[model samples]
Target: MQFHHHGYVSSDPRVEPAAGVGVNRPDELPDEIDVLIVGTGPAGIVTAAQLSQFPNVTTRIVERRPGRLAIGQADGIQARSVETFQAFGFAERIIAEAYRITEMAFWKPDPNDSSKIVRAARTADDPTGISEFPHLIVNQARVLDYFAEFMANSPTRMRPDYGYVFRGLEIGDGEYPVTVTLEHTAGPNEGATRTVRAKYVVGADGAHSRVRDSIGCTPYGDKANHAWGVMDVLANTDFPDIRTKCAIQSGSGGSILLIPREGGYLFRMYVDLGVVPENDNGSIRKTSIDDIIKQANEILHPYTLDVKNVAWHSVYEVGHRVTDRFDDVPTDEIGSRTPRVFITGDACHTHSAKAGQGMNVSMQDGFNIGWKLGHVLEGRAPESLLATYSAERQVIAQNLIDFDREWSTMMAKRPEEFDSPSELEDFYVKTAEFPAGFMTQYQPSMIIGAANHQNLATGFPVGKRFKSAPAVRVCDANPVQLGHHHRADGRWRVYVFAPDANAAVNNAAIDASTLDDFASWLTTSPESPVVRHTPEGADVDSIIDVKVIYQHDHTRVDLGTVPAIFLPKVGPFALTDHEKVYATDPEVDIFAERGIDRRGAVVVVRPDQYVADVLPLSATAELSAFFAQNLLPQNASARV
Candidate 1:
């Protein structure tokens, strides 16, 4: 499928028409800036958008090319990336523009011959548990356009100084800042050079990053020599069954995936440039439009080959490497300390385009680091919080790289030529049945939902398997009261397990008579171990609110009941049928099963919704200390 517009606004009128590098750049560049982003790709744009959110921060993005966003580099938007968009208040816009793909169709050739054309499987029919925006099908350029608009609303705006070629950087501990030189590509100011000065810099530059090189950071991993050609087009021809993500590996030549992007199909074909002789020169320069269409059709199956219009297309090699270091540091330091200057997106890691992790990973990287940087720069968070960026994100990136390697290997493996004795074909067939995580791992690892529990006997069991926070069910029939940032307020909310319990009994239990009695008992009884406070004017519906729970518990518990009132704010509140037990501790296993440690009465979660510090029940002082260390003065530790 392809799309062709008879006439459109051409940003580059005097198009030099060079593929990667080796194009003449613009002469003039920005003179001053606080933060300079190196690339104008998704990563670069998203980073600029995020950085622009800070009122004090000055950001400018540099695009080497003089055009709009790429047509179809990547399409899949993982669950986590959706959550991230919500944080920035643009998830809805993205979802509206993109197609919601509930199912992925996987097929092979031949019914009887299970070796090569094994079987077809799909996930569309399965139930997706509790999510509004399940999946989407927007292109990379449109996503960037959304971000560009969002950034425009912010104090710091994105200035599109296109065709600016990066010369080099002047890095030092002293003043003068980092100097970035760029030259104009066209017009009277064409050969003019301009220098930009910024306090901090970001290298959102692509895999072969000039900014990365200037910073002395080295990318780690084996280089993939193979190149793939992708023909992104818009066509009227219909593949009724092709909904969102589709894989056609059983075709005449090899694998051809027709992902249903917005308005048209992003037809990606895995071409072996090494084997194909004509691909050597990298010059489709003189090839007519018809010839290009023919080439694309030949690459895709002949049966499905019918192209009327070609909107945009590009062929490029893949970068299959994860950089060991994102920013340069003194070799003399000898420790993996944080770099004041950080690089993210493709600059940090690059993998095969098969899983479409490129843009997604880049966006996640920005989301992960952008907020942290904002807080630290704004003095809302401790400086030490910045260190957590690499520690958390590196693991995520490594896991994704591992998944891509497996996916790439599976696609490269020609099971048709192999023997049937090993049951290897069965493995691939089962892989088709498994979740998308089995192939991409990035989605499952990064996405909050569908995660398992981590098994740890000691300390704050920090691993990938953290239970997702329950979000406000907006679509549900029940009129549950909801609030802004219901998902990411960094509060351990507790709900009294009174699900549909008798309203009369519930009222009787908390009304004037019983409330006063309970409060008196809590204060006088030596056995009472809970704090006491009033839940006056609180939202008392069955739906849980941390503030409400804390108020109710504090109102009921008496002063002398338990010598020291265990502050509900900094300890695990028991929720069990076993009832209150002052003589014995609550069952640790019960809390552990719920993925919270009972021993650490207090578990502090980061604002991004990940566990940060866990405090033991025995040491209430440590809870105070945890707050002192984890939060800034703005947090108002007294409130916690």
Candidate 2:
């Protein structure tokens, strides 16, 4: 029989096997909960699911909504967010539900005649030639539901409950145990509120976060005066294939964003409230859409604007601001002690919808905080680690604001007149100056955290680093069936780099080697997995690229300090300048003599495929110690 785990059980088990979580009465409250996650959006649910992965943790998510958020809240799944979904074993579901749009169309009105002209076209054509999972268009609810499923199936036996509202919170106690007051939305006992004591509380509630308000935390940033009316229309229209477009329709204040969804177009109409300021805060009303669309038609002359069926509609006021810090500070601050009650997504920062970053940014906010919370809950790290969340995510929030600001500026600039690269350079300079380098890793959340044994300065918690690695099909030429690497368990890996030894040594454990013994080790080592380069052997590229390391470049490094083990032909490598000895010298005469890519170095790869440490082949003891300290130990000494 198949044994499936954590999920909500509704009355109809077949249809809602794990959909609704029964409410926990006030009397039934546990003595202590590992975490109290506020909000049910992308960030809250993802954090709860991640926290529930640890066996000892009991996480409870309190969402005020009576049911799942139904609407076109956030639509696009950025490449990085998709990878994080892969880690949670939900990427497939997202991909299945999403509509794949590879191309984007941006049209601007001809200022002279009011006729539309193609401004720029964007495509996911593998420009970087590295990403495996490109962007996708999935509704925000589906992603949240995946997170809900993940939490329900977690080893911690905790699932998110909808229709539960948080009434109040108290965080002054030394142990950080929070008393969360919650009540169900429906039923006889619906309005009743009960107090729940939790070890930690995460305020993932949106922009106007109740948790933030209760915690006395006020948002800091420049609020936008204009509010945009974004409507998601479900209709078969003329521009079915228009994935994204910055159309400057006639009579416009700000440009409109036309995002073609599955049988729909997510339109963002820039409602001009007059020249208040950039990213100033305001509100949007439904009546404003008709005017906005009218302007859109007038500005964008070529495409006939037709209002079909409106599936979902909402207005959001954009802002450009970030919380000063994420942790505790002087008592004078508004929410100083409430730093433990962290916020993400719209709660922390807000930006214009131009860069198509609303959903992408929200998922990333969750990605940034989830793993760090997990680490802290496991007791594997100190409370100081949690401080990094605000530090890291705040910068990302700032960058998003900056990116949106610049994008708007670029859109405002006349494309035809710009001759010099000055505009691009200015944009790059602004981006480069942004504090959070974490934005790049946000979408693909796959880079592994550096191990303490590797580098102390860069030893971010494992979750942050792990979120950056790519999940791809590690292809092989052989026709035999094989299992792909799974991220479900969240386990890290250590790849031993030595000249191919006998297949016996290819076992899970990495064995260090000496440079001088390299040639002899490959030919004579009973456990060596490395095979000598012969005309009869398998293709060298396939062996190393596909089978051994899987799809990703799982940490290539010089095996050791042994000078003899250094790569035969290398001045430098990407991650480090360390040398790498070839497994078997290639057959190519020039390469055999001049050396080849660093193929022999062994690396300790974190579960997220981040390089933890590079062990020189010469020192087995040192390598063993490094692994023993960082990875889950087979023996009691390393076990935490």
lDDT of each structure? Answer: 0.49, 0.49
Q: Which lDDT tens digits does candidate 2 get at residues 278-321?
A: 43333234446566556545545466568776666666555676
What are the per-residue Cα lDDT tens digits for candidate 1 across 204-303? 7777788878877777886454455565665544444444465545434355555666654544343433222434565533345455555444433323
The candidate 2 region of ten consecutive residues with least summed lDDT is 631-640
Look at candidate 1 and tell me the lDDT of residue 395.
68
Off by over 4 Å in 1: 1-32, 65-72, 111-119, 124-132, 155-163, 175-177, 185-188, 236-240, 251-253, 264-302, 330-338, 381-387, 417-603, 613-620, 630-640
**Best of the candidates, TM-score:** 2
Model 2: per-residue Cα lDDT at residue 52 = 60
